[model samples]
Target: MSDSSFRILIIGVLIACSLTHVRSDASDHRYKVGDVVPLYANKVGPFHNPSETYRYFDLPFCSPDGIIKEKREALGEVLNGDRLVSAPYKLNFRDEKDSAVACRKKLSEQDVAQFRSAVEKDFYFQMYYDDLPIWGFIGKVDKEGKTHPNEYKYFLYKHIQFDILYNKDRVIEISARMDPHSLVDLTEDKEVDVEFMYSVKWKETDTPFEKRMEKYSLSSSLPHHLEIHWFSIINSCVTVLLLTGFLATILMRVLKNDFVKYAQDEEAADDQEETGWKYIHGDVFRFPKYKSLFAAALGSGSQLFTLTVFIFMLALVGVFYPYNRGALFTALVVIYALTSGIAGYTAASFYCQLEGTNWVRNLLLTGCLFCGPLFLTFCFLNTVAIAYNATAALPFGTIVVIVLIWTLVTSPLLVLGGIAGKNSKAEFQAPCRTTKYPREIPPLPWYRSAIPQMAMAGFLPFSAIYIELYYIFASVWGHRIYTIYSILFIVFIILLIVTAFITVALTYFQLAAEDHEWWWRSFLCGGSTGAFIYAYCLYYYYARSDMSGFMQTSFFFGYMACICYGFFLMLGTVGFRASLLFVRHIYRSIKCE
Candidate 1:
């Protein structure tokens, strides 16, 4: 195919994929009175640990038929541990069903034991009908909701009442409630005949289809800490504003005075020795060691930065919502793959700017910088999930699909971007030229060392987001649903501003100390925030959360490592970009001869 045709085909494919996602849910279809409505049973897991889920049929539940049929789901759904399968409940649009026995089974001793165990762990089952999710407990503890194995009575919820609300012909909301009276006591060890019963009720409502998900957010069983989230956001904003104020003062007053003094000294032809940042102007722009790695990091960071902003923007516009299973993950994967070109262009352009050859090597490094680690981690996690028979495990087909996307879509775009970047004529716009011979650096105090500077620089940015991080952790690891994208976006912007200002301030200090090797140090100083975030993850795992087991622990830390690594790159790039601009402005204002 011609280049333009290939590009057009790729664009068309992407648009088709996006449109498919938008209309993936069954609710998007307009149904007549007798249209068949399918109900899909998702995963079931302990209420306390959200990440550890298994297929709904893992337990000894009565199947609709001897052979089970699985429903095809989106990539996001699979990643989020959703194993959607056809349920036995049969209903048509606008059709109401009285109490009906959906399935019947004679429970054996093993079956009773399974139910007992599930009830003991407080397992919850998730189901979807008309693209609306419904959740209910598998069983209940009878002793005043306490899980005392010796005293509390365990009962299986054998009957379910699906209350579905509709606006005209469109389903607006769905809720599942267990019939308390129909609970079957699992205290006995003997075999029993259990009849799984269900009733469907369709009611008319004024709520529109677009607003169907609002009920889930408002009436969620999980705790809503809106006030706490707002407080944290406000606190972070104040911290950022103060830091910005300090930075503005330095730029406006201190830097202005330094510029005036330097210009005056140049006019006087003073032979006095120069001090502070002014003394290191010649070496500040020197290309650092490991040019390939540095350029790759910047490129990956640029892609990640763009991905984050776009994800948040989509969430703000309601393209993703709490009830939409796997939507966020799906978006993340697709966007990351599509934005691979940004990374290639940035890495290539920056490498070219530094007068580095071996462009192919640089491009390869940029492509693998983040993805290599992520792929390895994912492989390990997938292996663990497979071992444990967890629903989080991706099927072989899904893995093949993802690999194809990376190989075909991501690799090609990255190469194209690299080609474009290499052909560009723009050069590195450094205000000062580097000296032929390197200058000898003076010894600094222990407190002024790179390590200390990184710690100090990283802590401020970490502090600004730790409170918000708690909420995010809860949503990801616990049962809470995160819906306040606006607050999250605000916190995200605050984090970037704080990171940039703090890194710039520290870079200024490093330069004043006559440290010409600020390239890697500045990057490390900003990236150190990821280290702090990982530390906080440890603290949260131990102190705040009750998540346990090898699978959950491994998954949590493994994925968190990837997330923090991305943060390190993205924020480090921000710091480097800001510091580069700051250095150029300061050097450019003076008469450098």
Candidate 2:
């Protein structure tokens, strides 16, 4: 196809995608009601407002570990540390007796019984503390608080709970009456429930519903908890111990043996050179190809990574409308597009410094990989959303607003800044060393080496939860309600454990695979989890998903962004291991000499 025709075709594809995207059902894209209940933990103060508070809590990304740490790390402040955030607290649906509307003397005898019956029926209630809903943490009365029947205490149960049974025919207000931790339970260690003091008065006298608060974290800690997370936290120390013991044994043998095989010409006993760890410093910073292509790629990768993260973090903070839930479609588009600029400038500048090659081509290629695809993908989505009747998408007015921000605000700033840019060579540091003698580096046996094997280990755990992973990605691109934070947190923990275990095991495995070659292989072995992550993402799209056309077109480009991200992570891991291995090799070799 001609260039213009190709462009037009791409545009056409984007439009189709936009239509399906716009048609995406927002409600379904949220947390499902499979195992959810309402509680009031996060926003604990009805203080005096007799009015009830009801908000829907989506459960996407709801995992126990995440709930504990999400805000702790990001916000630098966790407001409700004591309050347990959990679902299945109590969900109240409206029935004949739900409101004051049914409590009047004017009500007929039939109506009064019907309303009372509704009130007596048990239903599940979800907890809404502040703006965010709790996925795991549930509240209970403190140890000292007096015991109240299921009626007075608003609790979120961990395994099973005791609450009023639900009858769909009766009206029940799934609301709490805030109360005091009555002094009746003065004896410590008793299982006392948290109290909810209601603000209602006889004939409605003075104060509003008497509200008070306390969280319900059990005094008991599960040290052996294979279910709760912190168990893994302590196990790391054990892992370190075992690793240390095993490696110490290997080190004892390796050091005593007069083995300098790679460095010698059959000199089994030649005293090894006593040297310290030194990186190939001079050429360390040099571009891989001494050309601009690699430089541009590296730079572009960095830029895209930074921009994408910024948008995601912003979304996490609820900066976007409808909070974090509503911003995915736009966040995906903006993050991808914004990263292009980062990629182009970084790639071009680094390449210019490394190769002293043509800058224009480097810039263009970087832009193409990063910026070009992004624009095309987004444009297609915009068009398709319009066609598919997705009114929730950015409207024309929004488009105008976006363009104005892009052109006037962002573009002008970048253009002006580019003029005063740093020196091309200085932009990237030169490699510390250049090889005066070519050394033949043998490739470590793939499965035999520790690092590669360790890297391989990430596969199993990735497989264990690959189904959930597939769902999450599909939810993001397919524009579905992706609630399920609780389980996702579990998945996240699994991935972490898998990666760490493999990395540690591979450390020993590579060393055991072959002793001397342990240095580089060890790094590669434990660090290559990124590759598996990439493969799985592709597998999800190609094998598991039959996404919409717009999503399909957007998928590859979005995927490449992920791939690029994985590659760098792998690169960093490999680099760290290699550095550590290099140091060890030098240290022991010198000690023997």
Candidate 3:
């Protein structure tokens, strides 16, 4: 096809996709009644203001079969993606009295007799249709009835049922209609029982109830619109590219001059030699303090780096999304567990190279440094969530499962990695041998210090990714679906490149200034981006989002902190490796005898 024709065809495809995403009623996609469809309740307070305090709590009482069709706005067709469970409850549509009695039996005697609150509260039901949650208020309830004292009366919900017609393939037609009169009422005990009297047959028509049901699907997925911020991405990329080019040009020019000067000086008649990075080659590679700890961090960071890369690749390929619920979380947990071996191996190898003898201590520190803090933070946050009756809180069983995964899968792999790492015979090769004692480090100005270098290094990497970070935060906190994995993967690569380049530049400058303590500084310089990310998250929560309640606050900050820490480790490792290579290459270039 010609370029214009291709463009037109692409646009046509996008429009078609946005208009309708047809899916077959296959076993996996098809939902049945009484199959335990997940229901999320959004509780509203006085004046029906949505209490954005707690996350949706699962209501296991009613199994609702609904279709959550997400509109592919770019393509103009709706795609059927599953974000939530969509099985329906098998309600034996019998007499009202019998249905009520059956529902009453499902609840405890105390629950059936007692009321929750005196004032009526608005609880919205988030029905998972096609695995997408379409939230709507079902009914109103008052603990103390306005007319009857100590008695509660629940209002009934009346919504139109979407009758979707398909030719023979079970694919939904664009002209779908909503047949009015599907009713359900909440009893005094908060039990859900459908009103069989209000049920109706499939009413096929060209148009029913004002607009087509497809409009509702479009609106439902509106929040999750694929917003490709092209300008922001381009701006970020250009800025980072410019900065990278400048740093590379300066480093190359300066290094070339230094190499020429050193070579000329060495061949001169003068006995005295100049002092710089070359002069301290022996002490530069000397074992840093807390060697064991450093090795462990490096190992874990490496593992995390690999894990992130793999996950992003999978996401980009569409293997883990648009269908599976909780797949990402499950994948992360599993992958991280598997990568524990990598962590242990890298840490142990580095420690052994540093001539560390206490293997047990090294191993323990490697495992505890990140994981311990993570678990503790999660526990504290979970406790707070539980206390506040938040649905965001992880259940006891889930916690147990996570713990078991770590213990059985991760722990054993870590041990195996440690053993393998220890058994390896690789030598810690340095260009120059270290002296008996450490060199006396000279004092430098504030700008030349490690802290300042780290701050500068971190800012560059953060700047490269800050724009993408906003979208990530929105998707996580705003109940929006982000499907731009290709763009995200590109941005991720850019972030890595920027991080490595800046770290190398900063490390070289620091070393040139006679600062032999570049080991930890290099790591910190790259890792400090996490600090910036965390700071951004705080700003996002307070300034951008209208999120309230202790649970939401805790969950956001708590998980964000953990994520930032991982970011730190990953970037820090990148920085350290780049600097290490730079140091080795420069040292080897000089005639250091």
Which is the leading candidate under lDDT? 1
Candidate lDDT (C-alpha), each: 0.84, 0.38, 0.62
Model number with the top TM-score? 1
**Model 1 spans with C-alpha error above 4 angstroms:** 1-29, 32-34, 143-152, 219-226
lDDT of 1 by residue, 309-352 (tens): 87877788776676674777777777787778888888998999
lDDT of 3 by residue, 307-413 (tens): 79757855766544432324565556666777777788889988999999987788888888789889898789767856865444565656677789789878887
Q: What is the TM-score (0 to 1) of candidate 2?
A: 0.41
Ranking by TM-score: 1, 3, 2
Model 3 shows how many backbone clashes? Answer: 23
Clashes of each: 0, 84, 23
Every model's TM-score: 0.93, 0.41, 0.74
Model 1, residue 267: distance off in Å is 3.3
Model 1 has an lDDT value of 0.84
